[model samples]
Structures are given as structure tokens and as C-alpha cells.
Target: MKKFLRKNRMFLSMCAIVFLLLCTVRTMYKFSIRDYHVKTNKVLGYSPLERAMQVANYLTNLEMQKLQKEQERIDFKYCGGPCRFINVLYIREQETRAQLHVRHLAFTSAKVNRTLVLPNVSGSHLGACKSHDFEYYYDMEWTRQNKEYFNSIRMKDFVAWIRERKEANVPVSDQVLSTFDLDTHVDPSAVTHCFSGLTKPKSTFNQILKWNITGQTCELSIQAREIAMVQFLKGPSLGNGMNANEDIEVLHMEIYKANQWSQMAQSDIPIPYHPAVIKLADTTAKSLGPFVAIHWRMEASKNTNNMLPCAQHLISLLKRKKKFNFFLLTDYPHMFTQEQQEAAMKGVSSTSELSQWLQSNSDSFLMTDFTREHHEAIHYLYQHDTFHVLETEMERGGTPPDHWQIMQIPDRLKLADVDRPRMIDSGWLGILDKLIAMRSVHFFAGQKGDVCGRSKSTFTAQIIDARTIMRKSRTNYFGPKNKTL
Candidate 1:
């Protein structure tokens, strides 16, 4: 009987312990749910639970935006914060042609993001739903081993970097984004996904212009014109009492030396000299001391029938009296129409017409200038000037093939790959070609030709249009009465 009583006592004690465990678990779960609710209110005041209730009852039509307020609040651009934003920006765009169209919108948006501050200042190129062009690949990284610029970053590392930045500005304590349905929880004020389009920069930008940006996530379909400067201004905060409003004198003659247009690119990392340009310049100066470089802007601006006649007259006038050397730096002569080609042939021959012109005008002491460089140089070429034709095989005799060869060697390093865009039909070499022509005693352009610019460094050189020289008809406009090479 005593043994039975002891066993009953043990059974009772076991029941009491089990009851205590149940109560503890229930209490803990209630507090956990309460904390989650509080966090949600702090972030996005809208409750996912309320939205879910609406979803369960009916699919509210967009036609009734009054009832739309009853529907789920979705943000396509937010992409669950930074990690997803970067992934979509870099990775998802590579998936399909349709996706690339979206990428282009993002690229143009980023370019014009700064001008958004101007009220009523509108932007476009956003109406099209589909486009074949892509411009986001501007900042390329050349890989030594691969000999290419196809570079990428890891998602994990990207995520960490974004988290660090957002932590300072975003409040995670409140939002409760929706998940896949009945089987899930819905939160109108919470988001775990985001997107980007027409922004002024890449996803790597970490600086936040203002706090409270967490609840203000955007959608991917937002128009480029809709973007405001206040919506996205995330560069380094202005300090040192400097203001963005300060408009300093715009100077960019040696911009290549001061700022590199690359990610993490350092300023003024010593570049190497282009061997061909150097060799050509040195050889030309040695062979022909001083000469005039006349730029013929035909084809595009050779109209009013003044370009060819004016150029020929100027060459004849200069050769007859001054006995000056001359060189032709015109647009593509080979690409000229038959009528245009014939007119050009009358000016100077491939050493043939030039030799005859010199013989007839015996006193003409002339030679063309082709070499280019600087006074103080420890071997450095900022521009790829050696990548074009040394001389054109046009109407006037082409320059010496030994020195002024057309185009760089067949296998030289080309700037743009077959895939990348180089500013519509023109390449980096086109700019270099125009620049090379400008470095002469007298740089001439058509009545409406593009003159590039006269450098402050090229002190004694003069830039003039063909019409002005033809009108003046004298060596006086050639500049500085007593200048030497």
C-alpha cells in the first residue's frame, strides 16, 4: 500500500513539470509576435496582415484606386534593399534581349540624374518599350591575361558593401514585405526586392543624401524625366566648406593627365609614349622644318562651292610668294564623290603634282609638317594618335609612304572591341586624327568646319577658317610676324 502511494506521488510531480513547460513556451511565443508587430509599425506603418485580408477576399481592380488603397503595396525598384538592387543591375540585365532594353533606360537615366534639379527641365528616350542599343558598358576594365574588359563582382561582397551603407540610413525594424500567399504572410509596408533604371550611377554608390529613404523605394518603370535631383544625390558629402553651387572656370586641356575615366583609376599614373606618332613627328621636323597645315572640310561642310577652290587658291598664293611649306589635313579624301575627287586632284599630286608645282614655282621653299609632341616629355602619350592613317592616298600626292603611312599597323591594339560602342560611327582615333591636324603653324578649317580647339600650350600657332584666309589673301593672318620652329 505504501509503495503504491509513493508511485502516485511521483506521477503527480511529473504532470506538474509538463504543465510548467507548456505555459513557458506559450508566453515566449506571444512576446515574439508582439516584438515583430512593433518593428513593422516603426518601418512601414501599413500592415501586411491587412493587405493579406483584402487579397483573401478579392482581387481589387486598379480602375478603382480608392479601393487600390486596399490592395498590396508593391515596389519593383526597391528589390529587398541593396543586395538585390546590385544583382538586377549587373546580372539580370544580361539574361535576354528584352531585359537589355530595360538596361538602356537605366543607363541614360544615370547619365542625366544630375540635371534633375532644374525645375521643368525634362528628359526623354524613355517611351520605347524595346530598343537594341545598350550604353551601360562605358567604364570597361582591361584584364591583362584575357586582353578584354569583361569584368564582374561577387554577389556576397556586393551585398555586404550595400548593407554597410544602408545601415546608416535605413530602418529595418519596421518593414514586413509580402511572401508567396495563403501559405504566406503579407506586409504592405515591407519589401525584399528592388530594381533600378535611368539612375546617375552604379549600384555600388554608398553615400546617402538623406535619411528616411527606407520607405521611399521606387519602381523600375519610372520615367527618366520623372527623376528629381532630390530623389537620387549620393556622392561624397560636400565638406571643407565647398559648395556644389560654386562655378569655377572650366579648364580641360590636360584633363587626361589629371583625372582618369575609370573605376578606382588614379590621377596621373605615368603613361607611355606612342612610338609611331613620336617617330613620325621627329622624322618630319628633321626633313621639313616649317610648314602650314590646311584642313579641308569637304563632304560634310564643303558646300557653297567654296571649300576646294578656296584651298587651291590659298596653296597657290602661299607658294608663289612666301615660299612656305604646306600640308593638307582634310576629311576623308578617298571617300569623296567622283566630282569631289577630281577637284581635289588638281591641288597637289602624290609627290608628282607637288614636284611639278615646285619646279614651275622654283622659288617656293615648301615642306609639310607631320610630327607631333611636347616640349617637356619623358615618353608619354595620353591619346592613341598612332591608330590612324599616316597619310591619305588622295588627289594631292600622298605624303612619303615611308613616314606618313595611313592607319596604324594592321595588328595594333584597338580601343573598342567589336562589341562595344564608340560614339556612333566615330572611334577614339577620329578625335586623335582631328587633333593631330590642329598642331601646325596655321590650322585652317572650312567656313563651317569643326576646329577642335587651339591649345594654350601651342602659343604661336593660329586657327582660321578657309574663307577668312581666302578673303585676306596674305601671310599677315598667319600670325606672329617673327615666330620660329
Candidate 2:
């Protein structure tokens, strides 16, 4: 009797524990489902799906809102965003070859979580569904579907979408986006399981701005465009109050359409309207032929008072025979105050308005000022009155070789954080080739935090024993006479 009672008690305890576990699991499931469901309410406090035909309809509306905001900020000639917006969505009419045609609508934030359908946009009226283009427009609504709106783009809006979800502490699973397309009918799931392929930048875009720092030292920044400014502002060092004058330089390259008549006449195969340009070997500064420009960005450091170590770097460049022209474009006189101006050139401000004025008027100079420490560089261009750099090349000569030789070389070489100048060869051709290929903006700093470092301390000089060498033939490759060695 005692043994039977003990067995019965053990079984009863086991049953009780299992029943408690079941209850806990049921409660957890209920909470998870509620969490996963879309909860944001519409104007009348309705759910997104409740107001839309499908999930995509709701998301497209979200995408449209984001695009409107982006469009408002785009200004290639002014704000200088990274890439320009190309209109993709359009309705087509005739299909001669019995082809199919499709059209896409822009999505926006104000219309997100709504349903959108086109009237008379069926296979019969649109001549079959062929292909479509998409973009998020942010504020517009569909002409047909008053009850629903378009959904935001799937992978294309990854950066914006992830940022919002992260802020709200929402757990957006990949399943939420697994079915959406990138832009056209192409699905994102074909490439990756994740909705966003975006990873953290190795160097944030905000670090590229010239004016974001607060350190009193002169600073310099180089960027491709104004969107680059936003990138720099978003960096980890943001709001650190480092007010250093900096240089923001951009190299602008562009393509131009050749005369259509010439293109049609010259081809066995139809020639493209624009072709990549190649430069010929020449010493003259003239444009050689029809071509476009490929822009680059580079930065230089400045002193605390917004002065440049020009003499030192120039001497080096001249001696080194570095290839490429050095055009000093800046807001020279206007950006600096009387005292600041005096300090820059020891109180001799001859070109008070040259830099800034040129920037405002020059094709090569953009709107930003490049004279101050916050915007200084050897090849820095804040603005350009003329983007026709290719024209300059065409008129100077068909084209100079992609690289030009600098006349002089620096005695020493300096890279960031290094104390002493390093020995480097002064072969102008080789250096030019490298610079053209890499198009990199380089900086050198000292342990004491001198941005450009003191020139004398940074330059490396070669000790030569003149007594040992024999005389050699001379050449003036870049001289007015164009003499050869």
C-alpha cells in the first residue's frame, strides 16, 4: 500500500509540471503573434492590411514618403548628392512587335500602408504586362486605389527602413520582406535572405565634411558632393565641438554628347553618342578631342588660424615633377577676415576676393568656399564655374597624357601620424600614373597633432656627392620650349 501511494504521488507531480509548461508556452505564443502583427493605426485607427489589398500595397506607400524627402534634398549642381534621381515609372502606349508593356508608380510615406490599383491598366488596355520601373515618391497617392496605398521598396529602401525599425526597437524579421522586389519584377530573395544588405561603413560618410569640426586648428575635407556633407555630419565624431578649418575638395568628371551626325556617319556598327576619352602625349595645355570628365575628391590639412603650408608642398610638387595641373581655386580674400587675412599672408592680403569670387563664378569651383582652413587642398575644388574641364583639355591639345609631370620634388615625404620624412623617388611619370589611378586624398600628421606637420621636419632630403657624377643631357619636358632631355 505504501509503495503504490509513493508511485501515485510521483506521477501526479510529473503531470502538474507538464501542465504548467504548456500554459507558459501558450502565453508566449500569444505575445509573439501580437508583437509580430502590424500595429500602427491609420487616420481612423485601422490596421495597414485592413486598408490594403496586399502587404506590398501598404509598403509601397511607405517607400513613396521616403523618396519625397530625398528628392527635396537632391541638388547635383548645388547640394551635390552622390547619385542623381532618374525617373523610372512611366506608362507606355504602342507595342508594334506584339510586345508587353508595364508601368510602375512612385511610393511615398504619406501614402504608406494603403492599397493602390490602376483603372484601365489591365493586360488588355496596357497591351500585356511587360516590364516596369519603380521609385519611392513619399507623398503622392495612386490615381486609382483610394482605399489603399503603395508599399515602400523592399531592398532598395534598406538603409532607411532598418534605421526606423531599429529606433522603434521593432523586431522586423526577414520574412516580412522575403517576397518583395528590389525595383523591377526581380525579387530580392533570389540574392539574399536578409532584407538589407547594408553594412556599417568602414569610414562613415560624415567624416568627409570639411566644416563639421570644432577644433580651432585649420581643417580640410574632400568629398565627391554635398550628400557627402551629410555623411560627414553622421560620423561618430559628430557634435564633438572640434572647430578646425578644413578643406573640402571634389574632382568633377562629366560626359558630353558628341554631335549625332558625326556618330552616325562614323560607324559600321552604331557608335555610342559618348565614348571614353584618351589623352595623347603632349606638353601643351590644350584640349585634344571630344570627351568627358571623371571627378575625384581629395583633402588637405590646415593650421589653426586657417593658413596653408603652400610654399612647402608646392616646392615639393614642383621638384617632384608630379603630373597634372595645379589650379589654386579658393574663396581667397572674402572667406578670411582682416585679422585672419593678415595672419594668413603675414598681413599682406593681395587676393582678398579671388578665391571666393572664383568659386562663385568659375565652372570648376562649386558654391562652397575653399580658401579657409576648413576648405583647403592642393587640388581641392569647392566649386567650379566651368565643369568643362574636358573642354580645357580639348582646346589645350586633344588631350595630355592622363598624367602630367610635376616640375619639382619635395626633399621628404610625409604620411599621417608619422614624424620623419620618408625617402621617395621623384619620377614624375610614375607618380602621375599612380595618382591618376588611385585618385586618393592623402594626409600626414605628427604625434603632437600637427595636421600637415611642420614642412621642414616632414620633408626628406637626399644628400648628393656632386663630385662623383658626369654631366648628362638635359630636357625641358614641361618648359615653354618643350625641350627633351
Candidate 3:
């Protein structure tokens, strides 16, 4: 053999190499076949429903290429229950499968005789579970019939009934409850006592009491009032009868308005504390930029309950941004508690006060005097050093105003005529339109005064000059035809 190998060493070596390569290729092909096994790849050709079951682990074993059935044999070794059964239902809708059975489902409201309705099962649906004896008992005809006692029935049937009732607009009440079988005559006290004994106190009375007293007190007090307000202000819930888009649009408008007001508060320039400097700045601020001063006044009836709600609304809208320094010039500072007032001013950048100056008979005899104070604020804003009113009267009058926008006049109204901190003019509407069109700023205040107080001199003075500003204006700035107005 040694002599033969020496004679044909190259030929023998070549033969050995070819044999090793063939063996390696064969081994690799076999391994590749095992790696790409059907169990690993899953059925790419199955229907969507078939694929879903496979993915969900419902299919246990493939009996044939076409007939794959779910593995329903739950391992009973875990529980000592008497028996088990696998109940399968074929559902046509994707929704039914997603919401599993046995979750919201109740088996029976009562045992043998007395039946009662289980209302808790109304909106909730069933969930899937695996068990031993429970499954066998659940499969029994007697057990299925007894489920009516608990209002726990087949989820598919229950869903179908619910759908019918929904289409009929039948209310969920005793009538609806009657559809389910419940043992009304069952003595609940014995069972209830048994369950009660098993239950433990969740927490100490003191802990729960503390939370109820403190945590929920604010919400409880205010939530009831808010609900009442919604009833009073917004009317009724029209439900599905109302156009959803229209409702959303109106809500959006309110949200936008609120946000804009909040933004205005942020942009508002505040007066410096120094008297001379404050005075100088107030006059110059408005002049430097073409901005308007908004003098807004909120009034509640004397000894009225309106103060809290009104203040809450105002504070909610005002706190969004520190756009403007709100000189909350008010008459009844006493109406709100100090804490409430402080809360309102928490994020407020600055506060300036022009006293309400209520005279001895300000309510009636000196009503005019109270009005003067409001007008003075407008004048203060127009020429004040802190606010810069950029637009000249001629220019302002000529320009069309948006719906809620306004501009002010300087040094025209007397101190006695200032009624509110701010005033709105006829030109305000047009001004608001302009602001909306330009999206220049969220809001601008032209003048702040009582609209009802027509003959009132302070407002009249500003309105008179504003009318002249309107007259000299190239556009019909104050008229209905004005685009901004």
C-alpha cells in the first residue's frame, strides 16, 4: 500500500478532497431543511383569520394541511376542579374576538330558585380564561341555564341582544335587566355576610376620612356648582342629535379666545413702581408702539352669589399668560377674599390700581363719579408713559377695526368719569376683525367703558373723538361694512 500511494499520491489526494466536499454539502442541505421548518416559518398562505389564530396560539396541532383546530385541552393538573370542557364559538366580527368572553359576563345572579337582575354586566363584556372543574360545570346545560341567575350568559348572545336594544334606544333599566335571568328569591344576606367576613378593611377610617375631608372637599364643592352652571349656561346635552363638528367648532372658538386673552396678558407692559417713572412710562409705552389699552370692568349684583363664579371664570382665563399688566381697578375688593385675590395674581407680572373711589352715595347719587374713574384709565393708557399708543387719531380713524378691537384717546376724559379700568368702543368690533385678519396679536384693547352708559361723558368723550377719527378715516372703519368691524 505504501508503494502504491507513492506511485499515485496526487490522484489519491484529489479523490479524498472531492469526497469530503460532497459530504459537507449534503450535511448543510439537511440542516437548512430543518432550520426552515414549518413550525418556525408559520403559514404564509393562510387566510387572515387563520393567520390570526395561529399567531394567537389558538391552533395547537395541524391535523392535516387544511384542517387546523385549536388546542382546547387545558392542563388540569394545576387545579383540583371536578372536570373541564373547551367551549368554542366562531365569531364573524373582529370586534367580538378582541373583546374576549367571560370578562364582563356573569354566570348566574342566583342559584336554583330566586332570581335577580345583574345590572353590573350591562356595559362590561367577557374575558377568556382557562380552568379545570369550572370549565366542566360551565359546559353543563343546567349550569348554562343557571347563568341567567347571575345574568352571565353566552357573550355572543348577550352582545346580540345589546346591539338590538341599542338600535331600539331602549334605556338600560329594570326592563333591560329583566332580559337576563336572575334568582330574585335567593337569600342574599347569608352569602353577603360570608363575603363580607372574607373582606378586609382597605384602609383605616382616619386615612379615608382625611382624604374625603381634604382631597375631595374642593372638587366636591366646586364640581356641583360647575355642573349647575353648565345646566344653566349651556342648556342640555343634545347627545348624538347634535352635530359633532359644530359643537367642536364652537368649543375651539372659545378655547382660542381664552388662549388669546391669556397671551395678551403676557405681552402687556407693566408700570414701574416709581411714581414719576411710572407716570412717564405709562404715557410713552402706548405711543412707542401702536397698541390699544383695554379697560374691562366686571360687576356683580350687590350681595350676590355671582362673585365666586365670576371671579373663577376671570381667573381661569386670565392666568394662561402674563401678556399684559392687569391694573385690576375694582370697587369691591372686599367681595373676594385675600387668598382668592392672591391666587388670581399668582403669575401676574405686575398690578396697578386706580381706586374705585366710591362716593358716599356712589350707588345712586354719585354714580357718575364712579364712571369717571373708568374713563380716566383709558386716558391713562392712551398717553401714559407705561403704554405706547402708536396710532395717531387720524390714522386710527382711517383704519378699519376688527369686531372686538379698540383704540384709546389721551387726556380727554376727566378722572371722575373713569367707571371701569377699561372700555370698549363701537370701533372695537372692527379692531378685533383687523387683529384676527392680521393675526398680529391675539387681542388689543381700544377703550374700556360700559356699553350701556351711552350718555356718560367719559365714554362719550372718547367715542366723540373716535367718531371724528372715524370721520377723517379713509375707510368706513366704524361702520358695519368695515371688514374688521
Candidate 4:
């Protein structure tokens, strides 16, 4: 054995060293892997067990929250017993009328302790009617937070509640909605039943709460039904009808009065323009420094003859204020007007009279002056189509004649086929105009008189009221005197 050991000693020593080296390498590798995993776990702040526990806790909380929401929905729908709801019909004209209608109804609902079903604004045109969610135009979060001021639900939610109730075999009141069209010669006797025969008393409330159109005293009485709908068609009478003198605990309600219906509508609620609108308006207004806003409603002026004269007068008034830039908002198609077209044919500068006047007089801006990005933002919002046909039908008192045909068409195709005019020509563009005008240093709108040749416009009224609420200057350049300017 000693002889064999001596013969292979060198080889034996080499094998031992190699074996030790191999073992050391293996040990280092194992240590590195263990250290890496330990560090990773430390960074994550949790072991496998802790992670599993966290996941389980998250799932449990999610399920609990969902259950809580469902319970709340059930509570709201059932209302602890027989459910009572007051659904207001949408005023299918423009944003101003629709907004005012909802505001008045909200006040009435809060006063009578009924859940107000708010109508979604219609984005329909001459060809097709498309319903948009209330949040599309206004801040719904404000309404949710201001439940103390008024308890209201979206028209869609109300429709869903009604459907669920019907499916559950719960009895719903089929009482016909009391609708009044004040545009026609509505007898006081016909609408007096709505007030339960309450006469317009010689009270301070009566003096403040006069109807906008008829100049009659505004009054209302709560209906005695589980489900009641009151629709005031045409004008701001519905909004003016609310008892502004009612002793409400809401702090902002103090500013509410009959004449200042717009202020009341937005009082504590501050239902500002939609976030997208504000974003767009802010972008545009940032570029336009210290500009005056002019809203010229030439399309439907009470006195069409006054429109041209009014425009000339407005030009003169703006000329006097030479230092300020001008932002003109008009329904008139300046590019497509007869005068512009004729000028284009005659090899003259293809500009409308108003456009030429504005260009020659002051640095003027229009919706067309918006940048590509600004226009793109507007288009993006315009593409946000919401289908609330079921809700709309319910709110409108009955389904349309072509309901079945409309239902047959797919929602996407329906939206695509809808004849949505250009943003400049569309009624919805007025929303953007209003937002921009509200931010202006000065606002001038057409008024009802021979001097202005403009009709009484709710659009102008709303903008002025918004300016008032914003504590901006109320200086307007409407009349011939331009005294405010």
C-alpha cells in the first residue's frame, strides 16, 4: 500500500485540489442564489405566505364593497316601502332650456322629498335623435355630492330601477304625467290644478317669482302619487316657478331668487362646464388675451331687419374699444353666406359683411380660429356617443312611432348614421361658445329691442348669469349707448 501511494502521489494531490475547487464553486453559486431570492423578497416586503394573505384580503374587500353597493342600490330603488319618483321630461331644444328644466325639477323634487329622475340631454338633429348621458354635458359628481341640496338620479338609473321593479312584480303608479305647454295660450285655470287651486297671493314671493314669458306669478304644488311626472314645456317658467323664498338650510340657496334662475340653478352646485369643455376652453382662452365675447344670434332674430343694423352698431361699439381683441360667436355661416358666395364669384375677397367688418375693425377670433389640436379635442368629445334610447323613451312620456325600427339598428351603426353636422353648425357647439364667453373680460349679446334687433335669448342670459356667479364684470355692449362698455 505504501509503495502504490508513493507511485501516484502527484495525481492524487491534483484530484484533491480539483475536488476542493469544485465544492467551493458550488458553495458560492448556492450562496448567491439564496442571497438573490432573500433580497428580492425583502424588496417586495412580503413572503409567499404574506402575499397569499394579501390577495385573499383584497378579494374579500372587493366582494364586500360590491355587496354594499348592491344593498345601497336596492335601498334607493325600494325607498323603504312604496317607491316614489318624479321624472322630468327633457326640453328638446338646446342646452340652456334642458339645464334650466332639470334645475327647477331638482328643486321641486328636493322640496317634496321625491327622487328626481334627471333627463339625459338629447344630441339629436333634424334627421336622428341621439341621447347622451347627463354627465356628458355637465358635472354629475357635483349633483352626487350635493344630494343634501337635491336628491336626484340619472334617467338611465331610474329606467333600470323601474324595469327591475316591473320584473319583480312590484306595483308602479301608472298616473299620467301632468304636462303644460306655456308657449300656447294655456289657461291659468288649466294649470291651477297643478297648484291645487293656489292663487298668486300679493306676497313678496309673488313679486320675485314672476314667469319669464307670461310675466304671471309662478307657483307649484306637489302631486299626491307614488310616481308623478311634471313637465313644463317651453321657456324658463318651470325654473322660475320654484319658491325662492322657501326657508332652506343650504347656505348657497340664499343667493337663489326668481329673476336669477340661472344663479339658483348653479348656486352651491357650481355645475361648471364638463371637464373636457373646460380643458378646451382653457386652451383657447390662454391664446386669446383680454378679449371681449360677442354672441350674435342672427339666425332666429325676432326682428330680422334689425340684425344688419345691430351688427353695424356692434361693429361701431367694438371700434370704440380699440385696445381689446374680439371673439365673435354667431350661428351665421360666414363662409357660406350669399354675400360671401357672390363675392367669390365676382373675384372679390370672399368674406361676409360681418367678417370683413370684424377683420377691418379689430383682431377677431371665431370657432374656426381654433387650432387643429383644439378641434381634435372637440371632435373626440363629440365622438363620445351614449345610447340611452330606453331611458329617453320613458322620459319623453312614450315611445316613438319608429321604436321597433330604431331598436333593430345596431347601436354603433345608429350612431354612425346619425346626421351630426359640423361642430361649428351643430347646436352642441353653443356649449363651447358659452364656456369661452364666460371667461371673457367683457360680453355683448343681442337684446330684444329695435336698437339691438335681437330677441330675448336664454343663451345670452345664461352666459351673463354665469359671469355674475364667477364675479366677473357685468359690462355689456348691447344697446346703442354702450354705457356699460
* Highest-lDDT candidate: 4
Q: For candidate 2, write residues 258-304 as lDDT tens digits.
A: 00111111111111100111121122123212211111121222342
The TM-scores, one per candidate, come to 0.30, 0.19, 0.17, 0.50
Stretches > 4 Å off in candidate 1: 1-291, 299-303, 320-325, 335-340, 343-426, 447-485
**Per-candidate clashes, comma-separated:** 32, 118, 91, 0
Alpha carbon lDDT of residue 457, candidate 4?
60
The deviation in Å at residue 274 for candidate 3 is: 36
| Residue-level lDDT tens digits of model 3 in 1-485 | 99998999999999999999999999999998886765455645556686678766744343432221111111122112211111111111111111222111122112111112111111111122111112211122433444433323243333343333334332111100000012222221111111122122121111000112223333454335334322322224578654212221000000000000111121221111113222333454433243223223323222122223333333344344246532221222212122323333343312232222222111222333333323333222222223222221322322221211223333221222234322222122222222221212122221222221211222223323443444522111110111110
RMSD (Å) of each candidate, 1 decimal? 19.8, 26.8, 28.9, 24.2
Error of 3 at 17 (Å): 3.0
In candidate 2 the C-alpha lDDT for residue 193 amounts to 17
Q: TM-score of predicted model 1?
A: 0.30
Worst 10 residues of 3 by lDDT: 249-258
Model 4 backbone overlap count: 0
Better of 1 and 4 by lDDT: 4
**After superposition, which runs of candidate 3 have C-alpha atoms over 4 Å from their true positions?**
1-8, 11-15, 35-266, 269-485
Which regions of candidate 4 fall more than 4 Å away from where they truly are? 1-81, 124-130, 169-171, 178-215, 218-270, 334-427, 447-455, 469-471, 478-485
lDDT of each: 0.28, 0.26, 0.26, 0.46
Q: Write down the TM-score for model 3.
A: 0.17
Candidates ranked by lDDT: 4, 1, 3, 2
